[model samples]
Target chain A: MAGYLNLLLRLTIWFLLTADLSWDNLLLGVTIAVLLPRGATNPGTLKDWLYTLGEVVAAIPQAYKEAFEIMIYPHHHEAITLERAKPRRTPSLLFLDIFLITFTPKTIVQHYCEQGWYEVHRIQRRPTP
Target chain B: MINILSDGCMIIGLVFWFWGTWPLLGQRSVLYKLHSLSVADTLGSMAIVMGLLLRIPHEWPLLLLALISLAIWNTVLGYVLAYCSTREIGHDG
Candidate 1:
């Protein structure tokens, strides 16, 4: 399917670029490709393809700035006292939001199944609504 | 000579890819194709950068920026792809 092919391509690209196709990297890439939102409306038209391309292109600078910020300052934020609060809402922009946060240092993607929520764990928590 | 060789090698990689890889895989899947092309773009530019770095040893700052930029880009792409894929496939359905 389109999804599988994309996974293969992403893996091949990473292998080609880094000159480090160790088993570890290959396994990691395979794991990621398999984990990607598959069948979530595969890009079927020229427009879809263009949109995906633009998304990737847009990720570069946003990621860079995040990296810069994390590097200059590494501190933790407050924690979520209550799990059900909308303040703990998952990112609305989905991939872009996920990319920005993970790209920033000291933050990780933690999946909480008790509430079935995916939250960003920052160094420090921010005031929530 | 180095720049020429670098360009030539990249071209060769492209050729090998189009001729050898594409036909074998069948390029109908847009996600797959884009993923592969992302790899190509990342590697293709990386090679050119590396070649330039080798040729110009004095521009350390520029080289450092290039390396950092690429690293950040790659990491972000990986994270986005993983998170989006997970949420889309796992919880959405």
Candidate 2:
């Protein structure tokens, strides 16, 4: 299931890259999408992948809201915090989580520690001293 | 209606560009700047592309590709940039 999801993603990219809907294009795209080397993804279920995808989509509006909040507000207090990862999260999902965190305006995962904590830097609106 | 909407999107996108980029001139940490840049810039570019997509729906394949790459790559690029700069700091200090 994960493999099929990867293929679908690749094929979609292929189609958009080719910008053609011809029968021959379809065949070649499928072939290439299938033949591409797979990355070393830790064992993760398809459900997890889909949930991550859903979160990615959901973050778009959230990103915009954060952007606006940052723009409208006064100076913010920045902080660095160590965040714990979900138990047994695959590397792929971990990467996605980092992406989700960093995609927003207020937080970024500065470093991923071998001890499994994310070194996060964040900004929050606080009253000026 | 479409014309107005597309123009509005582009306008909003331009605002985002300036909002995101204005911080580069300020005294701030790299990661802090990166946060604004990735979020606002990516969303801004996507908004402009969306405007274009609405204007010329025929060129959608290319524009769609542009949107996807902008969304995914820019966010990842922020991480990469942050990773590199922070590593340099760790090495020195």
Candidate 3:
């Protein structure tokens, strides 16, 4: 039920943002058809789900901080501390991904390695960019 | 006002297009070409819509609805088309 609701909400948001009835109707019908069989994926009850949401809320800040450090605004001094920090072979995608991640509020890419591993860090905002 | 902005945007969109279209200059894969074209179309249409918005005075609601619909359709169609082309061509990344 929760998953169904989540899908519905997502689809509605997509519909509004995009304003395409064809895409919106197709996606909505598909979501309903698929979700009817599987129901929900949570192993726990509703209360447990709520608690997990709380945990996720707490983790967001740390994730954003980590992401920022890894991908977006890394300290040059810290780069010295981290000796393994070599240039990435795929700089274009890495840079683009970081820019996209950091462009959003409360998210930052952190600890970006040449191996394409990234950690996301989150932080609270005070309105001024 | 919207007309002027739209015209400016259209000009910029054309610049992206000219750079993206050439085989020799871009040397980009089919997928990248599609992506660039998608960007160009979106930006170009935005400018055209801006011009329409300025010129058409009334019916703001309908105009906006049409604009949003067109943009969404364009994006989804371009993405799917490009994806299909890239898959067929077997371009790596």
- Candidate 1 C-alpha error for residue A31, in Å: 24
Number of residue pairs clashing in candidate 3, backbone atoms closer than 3 angstroms, sequence gap of 3 or more or interchain: 21
When just chain B is superposed on the true chain B, each candidate scores a TM-score of: 0.56, 0.94, 0.63
Among all candidates shown, the one with the greatest TM-score = 2
Candidate 3: interface RMSD in Å? 11.8
What C-alpha lDDT, on a 0 to 100 scale, does residue A72 get in candidate 3? Answer: 42
> Candidate 3 DockQ category?
incorrect
TM-score, per-candidate, Cα-based: 0.33, 0.93, 0.37
Candidate 2 deviant stretches above 4 angstroms: A127-129
DockQ scores for all the models shown? 0.06, 0.78, 0.05
DockQ-based ranking: 2, 1, 3
lDDT by residue for model 3 (A65-97), tens: 442343344221111112222233234333434
lDDT of 3 at B43: 39
Candidate 1: where is the Cα deviation over 4 Å?
Answer: A1-53, A78-101, A112-116, A124-129, B1-93
Candidate 1 chain A vs. true chain A: TM-score? 0.39
DockQ for candidate 3, C-alpha atoms: 0.05
Model 1 Cα lDDT, one tens digit per residue, A45-119? 444445544775675555434433533453224332223322332222344344444443334343334453456
